[model samples]
Target: MPTLESFFAPQDNIALENEAAEQEAHLIAEVEETFMKLIEIREAKFMDMMDAREKKYRALLN
Candidate 1:
């Protein structure tokens, strides 16, 4: 039982678009943070392995 004017209001579209944009921004931020943390963990593991290999090689040399 709603009128056409109420259904097709201009402000409604703007509000919906703004809400979608905010949600997208929030999701992007979360994904970026997760990726950074993953990268840091990978780097730390790689460094640890490299150190272990170097120590083993030095022990063999000596």
Candidate 2:
């Protein structure tokens, strides 16, 4: 014999909210990692270009 309160229990979205939060956290982590990789690649490219320029200048000087 169920009570009227049980029949009219509130339907909360706690579970859905938690699931969405978890997904958002995962996406943020992935985006951060990708951004770090992009920064590393940019640095590497800049270093390579500087090295090439230095070699050209040294050749011109000699």
Candidate 3:
């Protein structure tokens, strides 16, 4: 049977490296997607608050 350390040899090492890189890319993409969604939600909420504030100020002026 092969030792555990044997897996770290050239061929197997390359495979692990590729898998790790692929996973990293996938995680990065997921994070970016979630961040963009959060940004959109934050902007929408800010706009809503600004609109409400404008209405309140207008009411006070009347």
Candidate 4:
């Protein structure tokens, strides 16, 4: 049995390596998408904060 397994081991290893590479690439893409969404949310919040501050300053001046 061991001898039979050894004979097929190289093919099995190649298949596993390909699967791992595919999974890694998928995970990296997901992480990048999530990061971009977070950045967009942050920029929106910052813009809102600046607008509110500008309104407050105008009210003070008036």
Stretch of 10 with least lDDT, candidate 2: 4-13
lDDT of each: 0.94, 0.87, 0.95, 0.93
* TM-score, cand. 4 vs. native: 0.83
Off by over 4 Å in 1: 1-8
Q: Whose lDDT is greatest here?
A: 3
lDDT of 2 by residue, 1-62 (tens): 98655554354355566788999999999999999999999999999999999999999999
TM-score of decoy 1: 0.86
TM-scores, all candidates, are 0.86, 0.80, 0.85, 0.83
> Which stretches of candidate 3 lie above 4 Å from their native place?
1-5
Clashes of each: 0, 0, 0, 0
Tell me the tens digit of each residue's lDDT in model 1 across 1-62.
Answer: 88855776789878888999999999999999999999999999999999999999999999
Give the local distance difference test score of model 4.
0.93
- CA RMSD of each candidate after superposition: 3.4, 6.8, 2.4, 3.4
What's model 3's overall lDDT? 0.95
Please give, for residues 1-62, the per-residue lDDT of candidate 3 as tens digits.
99886858888888888999999999999999999999999999999999999999999999
Candidate 2 residue runs with Cα over 4 Å from true position: 1-12
Candidate 4 lDDT over 1-62, as tens digits, reads 36755766788979988999999999999999999999999999999999999999999999
